[model samples]
Target: MTNRPLPRSFTHVDTWVFDLDNTLYPHHVNLWQQVDARIRDYVSAYLKVSPEEAFRIQKDYYRRYGTTMRGMMTEHGVKADDFLTYVHAIDHSPLEPNPAMGAAIAELPGRKLILTNGSRDHAREVLARLGIATQFEAVFDIIAAELEPKPALKTYRRFLDLHGVDPARAAMFEDLARNLTVPHDLGMTTVLVVPDGTKSVVREDWELEGRDAAHVDHVTDDLTGFLQRLLPKR
Candidate 1:
């Protein structure tokens, strides 16, 4: 199989959207694992279930519903704010500052935004750790999306509408390939950020689906390098 050329020019893109967690930072950091544990704890306490049962429920919800929060909200009437607050309260110390990524994002030609299934506070904390908090114009979080997670067409539509973004002139970067489908369908360029092979990273089997699918226009392991490569030579 031949390697396809990455879209060298994003000059046409006016809105640059990025997913918060694994998309912005390397997955090897294990920051998400902390959040995952907190989510399981939350589920266990809220449902009064065993730890093992909560673990199962957490994974099940993620598979059935785009996010565990959404599934819990639909089935158990869980409050999104409470769940979000608890799950995102994990220590962010594992994430190191990336000035290179900040510079790369700062050089991108348009309105930068974070479109995350996570809460705004979580996004802000992660961005601050990445040293790129000031790069984004706004964060469109789960609360703003009314608890609708990514991979949902309605959520993507809402984000586009709320930001007055023209799909044809926008670009989205995310770690999960399935989450890019709606953006691809909406006519935005979709990039999938995969784990760099240097470290042993653990992820659910379902999370690995559609990685090489048609919806992904580009794929990269080093997000900062990829972003820098997209810039016009100075």
Candidate 2:
């Protein structure tokens, strides 16, 4: 693979979109484990089932509905608001502040937004913990997407409409390659934020596709470095 400067596709980007969780932060922190456990607990309690059963159900819902919240809402009539509030309540302390990432993002000449399947509360806590809370123009959360999770065209379409974003002038960065497909189809340049070491998408994102060559325009392990390179040489 050629080591190139920021491609022409990204040079004029007027809208920068990012996915929270493993995308903004690296995967080694395993902050997701905390949320995963919390979600399992919530599932167990809500379903009045054993932990193992809850785990099985959660995975099924994740595969079929894109999120446990969506599955629960559809089948169990669970309250999306309450579920989001509960699952995102875990301590966000695992994520330390990254002033470097903050600076890189601020240097980008565009509206910066976080498009995530997580709740606004979770996104807020994580961004504040990362010291990049103020760098974003908006955080379009799962709640804002009406509980339609990513990889779904509807959520991306909703984000475009709500933000008045021109996909042709935008670029999207995500940890999961599959999530980038819709954005690619919507005319946004797609970048995959690869995790360190041999790991990539976790088991929870069971529907994640490894087909980066088909939809992704760029791939990088260091998001800070990647963002820095996107800035025009001064």
What is the TM-score of each predicted model, taking all chains together?
0.95, 0.92
- Candidate 2 Cα RMSD after full superposition onto the native fold (Å): 3.3
**lDDT at position 143, candidate 2:** 84
Deviation (Å) of 94 in candidate 1: 0.8
Give lDDT tens digits, candidate 2, residues 25-58: 9887888878888889999999999999999998
Consecutive 10-residue window with the lowest summed lDDT within model 2: 203-212
Query: Largest lDDT belongs to which candidate?
Result: 1
TM-score of 2: 0.92
- lDDT values for all models: 0.90, 0.87
How many residue pairs clash (N, CA or C atoms closer than 3 angstroms) in each of the candidate models, in the order given?
A: 0, 0
